[model samples]
Each structure stands twice: as C-alpha cells, then as structure tokens.
Target: MQEFREILVAITNAHTSKAELAQAITLAADNQAELTFVSIVQPAWFENPLLSRDDFQSFWDEHLLAIAQPAMDAGITVTTRQICGHPFHEVIRLVETEGYDLVVKLAEPSGVFNRRQLTGNDLNLLRRCPCPVWMMQDKDAEQPAQAPVILVALDTSTDTPEQIALNRKLLASADHLALQEKASLHVLHVWDLYGEDRLQGPFINMSREQVNELLKETESTNRDRINTLVTTNGIGDAAQCHLVRGRASHEIQKLAASLKTDLIIMGTAGRTGLAAFVVGNTAENVFAGVDCSILAIKPDGKKHQAVSNETDANK
Candidate 1:
C-alpha cells in the first residue's frame, strides 16, 4: 500500500522458484525500494562438519549474485545476506535489525515439489514478522497486471473494536494497493451460521419457513455490518462488496479464483488454545487452496506468541 522504502525477501536453498524474485522485483520497481534477499543455511549434524565458514560464505555470495542479476537488469539495486540459523529466526532478525517494510517469499506448491519447501517457515514469518508478508504461489507469473484485480478477504461478523480496526487496516491497505496498481478492488465476506448443523437435528421442531426466515435475518444483519464497514472506511463505490454463504476457507479460495485475483489481501487474527495448535484459521486455509499471491496482515495489537512456542519446541 504505502511506498515500501525497504523490503526483505526470504529464500531457502531448496525453494528456488523464480516467481518469488519476479514478484519482489516488481514491488521494488513500483516503490523504488531497496531490496535485500536473505537465506538461511542450517547445517545438519549428519553432514560434513569440517567445511569452513569461508566456503559457505563464498557459496552464498555467488548464489545470491546470480539471483540478483534479474533485479539488477530491472534497474533496481539488490543486495543479499547469508545467515546460519533457523530460517524464520534469521528473517525476523533481519526485518527487526534493518527496518524492512515488507517480507516476500514463495509458498510451497503441493505434491513432489513440496518436499523441498518450508511450509513452517512461511507460517512463522507471517505470524511473527511485524511487517506484511507476501507469499507468491506461482514464481513464473509475470509482473502483476497494470490494472490488477485485488480482493480483500474479511470477517465481518464480529463488531468488536479490535475486529473493526483490523477491517479498517485491511480496507486502507487494499485501497492503497488498488490506487497504486490502478487495480479494481473487491471486498469478500464469507459467512457460515453458528450451529448450522444443529438446525437439521431431529430435536429441532422448527418449520422450513422458520428456518428460512432465521437464515434471512442473519444474512441481513451481516450485510448491514459489512455495509457499515465499507462505509466507515469510505471505500465508496471503488470496491464492490460480495457477501456469500459457506465455510470461509473454502469460499474465499473459490471467490479469489473466480475473480481471477492478482493479489488476495487478508488478515490473520491469531488464534489460541487447542484449535490454534491443531489447525490454521480461515486465512491459512484459504492460503493453502489459492494459487494467487497473498498479502497477509496481522492485527494492530496482537503478537502471535503461539508461533514462538512452536519454533522453540522445534529447536
């Protein structure tokens, strides 16, 4: 949204999809930002231990220079850094130490190519990186279109101050992106009624009309809230709002695909407890399903400590 003065793009030795670099170069070009590409080299215990640090350093310098050639040709200056530690930790350290405005990385594709990708590292960066993280699915994609199609996935059911502020942040960012890219903006809210499964139970004596009426009320109320959100943010007619019914994870993926979204901007409200441990939220689920790029936003105040716990456990 805002002009990114500095950007940090994370790469793993195993995941060398050029799309990530392409996307980063495009962004850097758009913002006139400086770029830093950093990758981590964590040696395994089973590997040779006698390799000198100088050897590793030399290897990375050459590797990164090759990667930088593309950006250099695009008229953007590029630099690279090599770190030896957990990928996420090193990325976070770089962002904090250097004040990077955004982090970019490639999302691991499914099937055979998945083995070399770092799924956990992307999640950690999204959850813990203070700035926004852009996850590119297809590295070969050309620079986003001149008038890119953008979608902002939202959760409009909650009216809490925190959720409201989060919505504002999302809309603001989306609007900025649309203006910057000369893009069309769309707002999507996928809703599922509470206890929807319980309504079909034998114990429930509600008639079909009653059920329809109740569901209608819910849809109306949610529409009102969504409208309020758009109005409050002054999105005006610049963005079209779509309110659909279904599981958010599935619906979001479908909508983004249907819209041919160039970038899906969504927020992740970090969860807690067992559910947090066992699964990802709507944002994560939609991320797994979509093939387009994602710009994930964390709420203004919350820090995802669960990721910290998980990373520590892995260590």
Candidate 2:
C-alpha cells in the first residue's frame, strides 16, 4: 500500500458537504494518519471586493472547525487553517508545501453552471495536483448510509513499466478502499481490436469467424492478466470482473450507472499534453457527467504542464 501519512481535506463552505468531512475523518482515524483541513477564503475586504474580511473569516472558521472537532474527537491529529485564493490554487499550494500524499474534497454539487455536475476547479486539481485527489460524491446524501460499490478501471493494454506500476497502484488503492468500506469491488478492462473492422473484405480477406477468434484471443489474454494480478496481489475472486469491448470512458460510465456504483477508482493515464474537461481523455470524459464519486490517482510526482498553463490562463 502507498504511504498516506499526511492527508489534506478541503472543506468548501459554498454548501454543506458533511459527507466529505465524515469520509476524511474516518480515513484519518482508521489509518492513524494526520489530517489537515483547509477552507479557502477571500483575501481580505479591501483586496477581493467580493467578500468582506469579517464575513469570510467567520464562514471559514465555522466551516473548518466543524470538520476539525470531529477528527480531534476521534483521536486523530487534526489541523485546520484558512487560506486565500481560488479553491484549486490553495489546495495545490498546501499539497506542495506540506507534502500531502492524498487530497480529499467534495465533488462540486450540481447547479445551472454545473451541468456536468463538477466544478472547473475539480477538473484542474485532478489534472495538476501532484497527489491523488478524492472527489467525494454528493449522491450519498440522497441515499441511506450503506456500503458503497467501488469500481476499479484497469488499462492492461499499456505495456510500459511505468504504466504497469501505476495500474498496480490503482488496483491496490481500489482493494484497500473497498475493504475499508466493506464495499463490493468491480474490476473492469476495456479493449477494442483496432483495425479489425477494416480488415474484413472479399475473397482473400478475414471472415466473421476469424474476427470472432481474434476477439476471443484478445479477451482471453486480458482475462489472464487480470487473474494473475488479483491472485498475486491477494485480491479475492468474490470481486466482479468485466472485460468489455468499448471505449473506455463510455463503457465505464455505463457500467457504473447500471450498477449504481458509489465510487470509481481510476488512474489518470493523461500526460502533460492532454486537454482538461474534455471527452478525449478518460478522466476528463468521466468527470464530465458521471454521478458517482471518482478517485483520480496520478503517478507519483508527475506534473501536467498543459493543465498548469490552462489554469494560469484562466487566472
């Protein structure tokens, strides 16, 4: 398991996101980890013009203190602070400054501007944050407390060692979180036999039977890889497995919705050149409309310069 001794949970005061606080607190207590909650506020009355110093400070303390008290009560070392700047910037700054291993924050609740149901800040952090970001779902508020179903999306197609290492870490995270919540685990690998359709033709070409055989072989190879991974990693067979032929983003979303999955644990395969909040990349496409919570894990210490430039342009 990855070491997550120092954790940062962002408490947004725009609305009541108590579920996120509860999640962060439970994780910190169970893991015996240190917790820090930061509520980003307006710089000052004279500076931001949008919010007064007194009002901003009041909301900040009330919001963060509510989360801090519970963590302290649970016997976890807790620290609360109020910072100034945009939500994404402050959180990223804290993660960089304090060396937090994981970032926990509530998914931006739905509103008119939030047609995708996720804030631009959410996408930015998931893209550029140097640590893993857990976007807790607001959907939990609509249902009774229960063990959530966690779906882990695996990309076994990538043959690089770095990609393989990241995939292993992603599965380890999925296993750990599912075990912690006593939730059902779902492992999925999406594959497409590229050029198979184009290869079919007249007299001297491939037939439907040949295509089927190729697909079967590809499926078998993927299934074996998954079996080896789970067995060697101590993951039990009770978890559901899916090897589907479809696009990664669409297939994962369809399965998560059908199963009413509570959280989808995934690794961001995006590199520094990927665009943000778009359908081209897996994480960005998933963030667009998936209702469930998502934990987008990045390879350790990799930065997305594309996202950074976009963020700077926005500022």
Candidate 3:
C-alpha cells in the first residue's frame, strides 16, 4: 500500500456513481493526498447547435463542483479541471505530465450480452498509464454487513525479478486496502503442468503415473513459492492463501466468486509496440469474467511507451 501523493478521479459523465466518488474521496482523505476531479469535453459535442463551448464548460464546472463537494468537506485539498480532447488520451496525457500516482475511474459496461466489461478507454489506461489504475465497479445494491473480501492474484511459477516485484506490489496494495476498509485479504496462485496432454499423447507417450507425479511436483513447487512470497512480504497469517490447479483465468474467476470478493489487486505486465494495444491475456480474461472492482499495477520500469507514441502520432 504505497501512499498516493496526488490522486486523479476521472468522471466518465455527469452520471458517475456516488460509490465511485466516495471510494476516491476516502482514499485521498486517508492518505492525506491532493485530489483532482477531471472530466473531458469532446470537440464533437460543440458541433451541436444547441450548446456552445462556454455552455459545455459551465455545465462541467457545475457538475464537478457538486460531485467534488464531499471530498472538499472531508478537508482534503481538491481541484477540478475540464479538458477538451478525447477522454482517454487526455487522461493519460495528464497522468504523464502531472505525475499523479493513482488514477481512479468507473468501469464502463461493454454492450455485449449486457455484461460489465472494460471499454477501450479503460483498457488503454490499464495498458499505458505509468501509475496504478483503480477501476471501480457500479453497484446498485448495498454491500453485505460482513467484512469485504479483497483478493490478490499472484503468478508464483516464475522466479524472475520482475514477476517477484509484481507479486510484492500486488500483495502490498491488497493488504493496505484490506486494512483501510476492514476487509479480509485472500491471496491466490494457480498452477498447472504445461503441455500435459502432449506428454501423455502418442507424441511423447508418458505413462499416467508419470504424468500424475509431474503434476504433483509442479503443485509442490508452486506451493513453496507462494508460501515464501507471503511470509517474506510480512503478510504472515493475516491473509489466507489459495493454491489451485487449473487455468489461471478460470480459477481466478471461480475463487473470486466463491469468496464474494469486492476488489482484486493484480498486475498487468506492460507491453511495447503493437502488443501494447491489449492488456495481458490473464488480466483481460479476469476483467471480462468478474464484475468486481480491479486495481491493476505494472512492474517498475515496464510502463508502456504509448503516451509518447500517441502524442507524436497526433502531432
């Protein structure tokens, strides 16, 4: 739980939910951080005959004031800015230039099958933003009285320094969040023997016992790794750890649902060039399956170059 020094909350529209605002305000107040409320006014909106650019500006100013009043009342330093540009691009540009440590925004629904999905803007921020992105989910119903559950997904199979750092980041973020909200923290690691089917097929023709032994060995090694990660991070017994054998994406969704998780803290390994257009496959799949809020982090020095590239492309 790195303390955020400067926090930016992006209002998707006038109707941004109160829950989202409250979450951002609470984080800022708790951290004693400066909070900024921002909204984007697309140039296309000005083309309509009914409204002038000044009218749009005035409307946004009023809207931001009304929504940001709670934060102001909490005695947190606050500012409001309304920029004119593409919403996603403008938000990233501000992040790059202003050095905000965290960006909070409500997740937009993807129209397919009426499922809650991350829109292109949300994905872009998760991919390109240099800082952590907290995407809050809209909830119409009240939460349960019991403690909220926060899950941190880790990939313990890799011993790479980058992956290890990411694991620590995810755990720290999740632990801090759980403490802040009086929530329960759960850590999860999914492991499997890659190409097990191929090994048992005619190509390799390994015996059933041998395949089983390999699976057992794989699980044992993952268990050791996850346990070491938890102990070394000072999490100790405060958090419950789960090691499951299955596909990473599917297991995550299943466990989150079973635990009724409120938020998931996970890493998005940054990509460059053409690959930067999409988030990591595991993260993307989990995003599509679970409707809970997500805090996506990137490993240190892994921030995508999309900001500079986009700026140049626009120029």
Candidate 4:
C-alpha cells in the first residue's frame, strides 16, 4: 500500500470544521507524515477598514496554531502558511512545488439550494492537482452509529495498461484508508451492455433471445474482471464486491448511499485539449449526487506539468 509522505490541508474559510481538521491530523499521525496547514488570503481581507493588516495577520496566526497544535502534540511534523493569491491556483502551486502527495480539504457547498456540493475550487483541484485530492463533507449530526464504510468505485471494462494501473491504485488507496480507519471496504463496478440500443434498432436483425444472451455475456465478462482485480489486490474475501448494471454515476451514488459510505475512493482521469477543463463526466455527476467524502486519484504519468505551464504562460 502507498503511504502519504507529505499531506497538505487547505483551510478554505473560517467555518472549516474541526472534525475535518482532526481527521487530517489523525491521518498524518497514522502515516507518520508531515502536515501543512495552508490558507489563501484574499486582497479583500487587507482592504477592509474594520480590520487592520496586523490584526488580520495575528488572527490567522492564532487560528492556524490552534489547528496545527494537535498534530504537533501527536509527534507529527507540522507547518502552516498563508499565501496571498487565488485559492485554487495557490493550493495547486504548493502541491506541485512542495511535492505533497495528498491534498485534503473540506468541500464547500454552493448554489442556491445549498446542497452538499463541491465548489468550483474543489472541482479544479480534483481535475488538475498532481496528486490525490481528498474532499471531505461535513459529518451529519444524525448519522448512524456504526463502523465506517468505504466504497471504492472501479472501472473494470477496460484492459488498457493505464486503466489497469489506475484500478490498482484506487484499490490500494481504499484498502490503506480502510485499515487506518478500521472501516469496512466495499468495491463497486457499474457495468452495462454498450451499444445495446443500436443492437435492438430496426435496422439490425437481432432477436430478443440473442440480445439477452449478449447482455449475459457482457455481465459475465465484467464480473470476471472485477473478481480478478479484487483477488489481485488481496481483498477478495475481505471486501464486499458489487457488480451493478446501470449508468455508472447513478449506480455509484445508489450503492454509496445504501452502504452509508463514509468515503469514496475513485479515479479522475485528466484529459488533454478542451476536455481538460472538466473532470470525467461520471466523476462530476457522482460528486454532485453523493454526500459522502471523495478521495480522487489520477492515473500515473498524468502530472500537473501542463497546468503549470499554462499558468506560467498566462502570468
């Protein structure tokens, strides 16, 4: 299992939850990793006449100290920094320059409805960060008092080398987290018969029985792939494996809810060209629908070099 050597925690606002901070501290201590508390200071903070620059600086110093003291006490190396720039850009800059392997932040809710949603900053980090980004949702006050559950979503339909490696990374991450939290691990793969509609089209000469047989074959193949992944990861009997046939995003949300998943560990593929502006559609949809925390990992060799270059050019 891959352990995080350096962890960066982004403090987005004054309302950042203590629960989330404690979670980060626990992770750093468990992994024996160095922890850094970072906050982006907007120009408006200094522009306000009610609060002087010195007063603001003093307040932030105290705030960060209070947040970091616990980790320090736990014998984990800790540091704090306040950078003045765009929140998303500065956070990614630190991750790239400092070689932090994991970025943890509390997901901020947006939109008029104020649903449990990932804000624009969270989405940007998930899309472009060089390493894994863990976005934690505020714990529900009435959540059930049961052992924590972690659901890992895997794409088992592809046999490409890159996809295979990504699947392994996801499984490893979830397994490591489950062990750390003493949580139950659940692996899910959502599969469907592709081009089924076209197969049933009027132009195609296909009988209902024939289509049913094809669907069965597709499901079997998916099951075999998922089982292989589970066994290879040494989680065959330890983790509950789920194979559901439906839309990927919908099925993930459904299973996570049913399992009362505390965290979801999944992959976020970073594309090139214009598509790079958005995360994978399935990931974005899952982010919107589920209230559970998400830990998104990118494929190997997909670094933030492109994003960094773009930022430099713009500057």
Per-residue accuracy of model 2 over 1-315 as CA lDDT, tens digit each: 865788898865444466777888878876778998887643333365787878766766776687688889988998878766667877887887789989998866558776665666776777778888888766446644766899999887755777777778888998888887788999999988878767686654888898999888888888888776677678878578888888899999999998888889888844555454453558767766687778989875566663333453224
Where model 3 places Cα greater than 4 Å from the true spot, the runs are 278-280, 308-315
Reference-based lDDT, residue 86, model 2:
68
Q: By lDDT, who's the top model here?
A: 3
Off by over 4 Å in 2: 12-16, 42-51, 139-146, 201-205, 273-279, 306-315
In model 1, which regions exceed 4 Å deviation? 45-55, 73-77, 109-118, 142-147, 199-205, 272-276, 306-315
TM-scores of all candidate predictions against the true structure: 0.85, 0.86, 0.94, 0.92
Stretches of candidate 4 exceeding 4 Å from the true structure: 139-144, 305-315
The window of 10 residues in a row where model 1 has the poorest summed lDDT is 306-315
The residue-by-residue lDDT of candidate 1 on 148-207, one tens digit each, is: 799998888888899888888899999887887789999989887787667767898667
Error of 2 at 76 (Å): 2.0
What are the Cα lDDT values of the candidates?
A: 0.77, 0.76, 0.83, 0.82
Ranking the candidates on lDDT from highest down gives 3, 4, 1, 2
lDDT of the structure predicted as candidate 3? 0.83
